[model samples]
Target: MIEIKDLHKSYKIGKNSLHVLKGINFSVEEGELVAIMGSSGSGKSTLLNILGMLDEADLGTYHLDGVEIKNLTEKTAANYRNKFLGFIFQSFNLINYKSALDNVALPLYYQNINRKERMERAMSYLEKVGLADWAKHLPNELSGGQKQRVAIARALAGQPKVILADELTGALDSTTSYEIMNLIQEINDEGKTILVVTHEDDIAHMTKRIVNLKDGVIIDDRKVKQVKALENV
Candidate 1:
């Protein structure tokens, strides 16, 4: 559902130039779960930003769900991103003062969805993430894993075509991380595409395909075994 070809991105640092992505090429099909693994400063997060349309490539193409987005206006790009993509960040970007349900409903508020309906949908997704009872709690009131679960519910509330997650389990303990990963795997099995960027090998193994990045280029792309379910583990 996403395609990138000869993607190049760079930034200027005074007199010198820093190249973040060097002619990167990749594609992700509908319903596929993919992982991008790289070391620190290896540009995997930069790639994820480009894929999520949060940042633009200096040169090359990015097409999402068949629309060529490289030439879109900022307004248009934001609109498209809201409609077609869901994002989960390593920090679990929830507002400190907002309750879990409110955070999940925030995106819908921007879309002009009415309060009652938005709350209903948000609650449904919170239930899906096993956090319905915790919906009234604020981010600070919840544990790291619980906050991430709320973030996942928020991402799901949009019903977007693809989910782009960057180090989703990075802040959690092993057991909690496994629980979150299994939730993502369940969503993937139900037909949403997922592209995760992680440094952990066990997290990378959760996907159907792995892309290893080094020096801002794709070094390896291959299919691997799916991660066993948490129950199985």
Candidate 2:
């Protein structure tokens, strides 16, 4: 469902350019749960940003669900992002003042979905994440895990073709992380293509495939025996 060929990216630092991703290439099929692993500055997050169309690659190709992603007008990129990509961040990124349900409904607002329908869909996703009971609670009222769950529900409300999560479990305790991974596994089982960017070995092992990155290049790509997060939780 996603393809990248000879992807290269760099950033300008003063007069010199820092090359971040060097000739990265990979394809993620529909319904696959893949983890991209790397240490800091290994280009995994750079890769995720490129995949999410948050940043353009200096040179390379990124095709999402079929369309080539390069040189897109900001407006068009925003449109495609809403249409095809869902994101979960390490920080949860929930608005402090908004209730869980409203945060989940924010993306739909951008899509021009009406209020009633937006809340309806958002509530369904909140329920999917087992947060329907907490829908009216504000982010500050929820715990870290709960906030992340709300973020996941918000991502789901967009109904994106692929979900790109960066360090999704970084902030939570092991039990909470495993619980979140269990939720992710369940989502993947239901046919959503998912990619998680993480440095944690246990987190990576939870995915069906692991792609290792070092020094801005792919070092290893292999399918692993999936470890059930529930068992660990």
Candidate 3:
């Protein structure tokens, strides 16, 4: 569902340019759960940002669901991002003032979906993520694992084709992390493609494939027998 070829990106600081990604070629097929592993400055975030349409590559070709992703107008980019991608962040990114139901409904609000449908879809996703009982609660009222579950529900509310998660389990306790991964695994099993950026080996192993990045290049990409997060939890 995602393809990038010869991707290169550089940032200018003063007179010298720092190259972040060099000749990176990557692809993710539909229904695949992939983990990208890399240390600091290994270009993991850069690659993810480019894929998420939050940033642009200096030189590369990116195809998402059969559409070229480069040179998109801001409006078009926003539309494509909303239509095809959902995101989960390490911070949970939930608004403290908004109730869980409203947080999940925010994305649909931008799509001009009416209030009734938005609430229905958001409630359905909340139920799917096991957060139905907590839908009316605020972020602070939830536990860390519950918060992450709410975040996951928010990401799924749109039913996007691909979900891009950055350090999704980084902030939680080990058991909580595993719980979140288990939820992610269930989602992937239902055929939604997912790409996770994580440095944690255990987290990477939970996915069906791992793509290792070093010094701005993909050093290895291979499929592995999936590890069940529920067992580890």
Candidate 4:
């Protein structure tokens, strides 16, 4: 569902240019779950941003769901992103003033979906993520995991084809991280394409394939056998 060829991203810092991605190339098939591992300054987040159409690449082509996005206009790209891409950041990125249901309903507002139907869809996703009971709660009333669950619900509410998760478990404890990873795995099992950026090996290992990045390029790409049985819940 994602095809990237000779991708390069750079920014000018005064006199010098900082190249964050140096001609990186890779592809992700539909329904595939891939983990990207990298240390600080390795450009994993930059790659994710480019893939999600949140940022542009200086060179190379990016085809998402068979459509070339590198040349799309800003409005077109934003429309495509809202339709097919869902992003989960290290921070939950929820609106503190809104209720959980309202937060999840925000994305639907841009899609022309009717208000009643949007709320129904958002509440259904919240129920899927085990956050139905917390729909009326605000961000301040939740814990890290609960907030993350609400964020996940928000992402899934739009029925996105690709989920770009940047350090999704970075803000939670180990136990919460494990739970969150399992939840993501379940989502992937339901046929959503997932690309997760994480520095933790334990978190990376949860995915079926791993891509290791260094200095803005992929150093290793390998498939992994599940080390432990995933919970059936």
Candidate 5:
């Protein structure tokens, strides 16, 4: 469902250029649950940004669901992002004043979905995330785990082809992190393609495969013995 080859990226810092990704190559098939693992400055974030179309590679190619992602106009990129990618960040990124329901409904609003359908879809996703009763609560009213659940629901509301979660459980306690990973596994069980960017070994083990990054390159990519999050929870 996704493919990349010889990807290279860099950023200019004052007079020096800092290379972030070098000759990166990989592919993710439909319905696969994978984790991209790396230490800080290992380029996992840069790779995730490129994969999410939030940034472009300075060299090489990227194909998402078969469409080459390069030189896209901002409008087109936004359209593709809405149509194909769902993002979950460590920071919930919910608007502080918006209720959980409205936050989940926000993407559908951008898609021009009508109010009735948007609310229905939003509520259904909230239900899936076990947060239906808290739908009307604002982010400040929820715990960290609850807020992240709301964020997950929001990501799923778009029905994107792929879900990209960056450090999704980084801010949570071990129990909550495992709970979130269980939700992710449940989503993957239903045949959703997911890519998680994380540095935690246990978090990466929850995925079916792990791609280890070091010094801006993929050092190891292999299938792993999947560790069900429920075991930890």
Candidate 6:
């Protein structure tokens, strides 16, 4: 449900331009779980940002669900982001004062969903993530794994077409990382497309396909046997 062709991006330094992505091309079908793996400075984050519509590419084309993504007004981009993309960051990115339930409901609030339905949907997602009992807990009150689970719930609350997770398991211990990946796998099984950006080989193996990036270009891309996270957990 996502397509990109010869994508190019660059950033200007003091006097020199730093190229971040070069001639990138790939496609992700609906319901596929893919991992983008690269070392630091390999342009994985830049690719994810462009895919999420958080940044613009300097060249080439991107199509999400058949709509060409280029030159979108800020308002339109925000609308499309809310309607089509859900993001999970390594830092959690939760408001410190907001409880897990409210944090999950935040996106729905932006969608103008009413309080009752928002809470209902939020609680259901929290339940789906196995965090229903901790719904009222604030981020500070939860452990690292719990916090990521809350983040996952928040990501799913919108029911977006694709979920983009950036280093989702980076901060957790091995056990917790596997747990989070298990949840992500379950979500993909239900037909939501997902793209995870991670450097860890084990984490990459949890996905059905891996795209390896180096020096701002995709160096390798292939499908592999899916390693079920629950087995590791």
- Runs in model 4 with CA error above 4 Å? 227-233
Q: Can you give the TM-score per candidate against the true fold?
A: 0.97, 0.98, 0.99, 0.96, 0.99, 0.98
Model 3 clash pairs are none
Error of 4 at 98 (Å): 0.6
Ranking by lDDT: 5, 6, 2, 3, 1, 4
Q: Could you tell me which 10 consecutive residues in candidate 2 have the lowest summed lDDT?
A: 57-66
lDDT of 3: 0.95
Candidate 1 minimal-lDDT segment of 10 residues: 224-233
Can you tell me which runs of candidate 3 are displaced by over 4 Å? Answer: none
lDDT of 6: 0.96
Q: What is the total number of backbone clashes in candidate 1?
A: 0
Evaluate residue 218 in candidate 2 and report its C-alpha lDDT on the 0 to 100 scale: 98
What pairs collide in candidate 6?
Answer: none
Backbone clashes, each candidate: 0, 0, 0, 0, 0, 0
Residue 213 in model 5: lDDT? 95
For model 2 the TM-score comes to 0.98
Model 2, which residues run further than 4 Å from truth? none
What tens digits encode model 6's per-residue C-alpha lDDT throughout 1-233? 99999999999999999999999999999999999999999999999999999899999999999999999999999999999999998999999899999999999988999999999999999999999999999999999999999999999999899999999999999999999999999999999999999999999999999999999999999998999998996
Q: For model 4, which pairs clash?
A: none
lDDT of candidate 5 over 93-143, digit per residue (tens): 999999999999999998999999999999999999999999999999999
**Global lDDT scores for all candidate models:** 0.91, 0.95, 0.95, 0.90, 0.96, 0.96
User: Model 5, residue 94: what's the lDDT?
Assistant: 98
Q: Give the TM-score of candidate 3.
A: 0.99
Cα RMSD for candidates in order: 1.2, 0.7, 0.7, 1.7, 0.7, 0.7
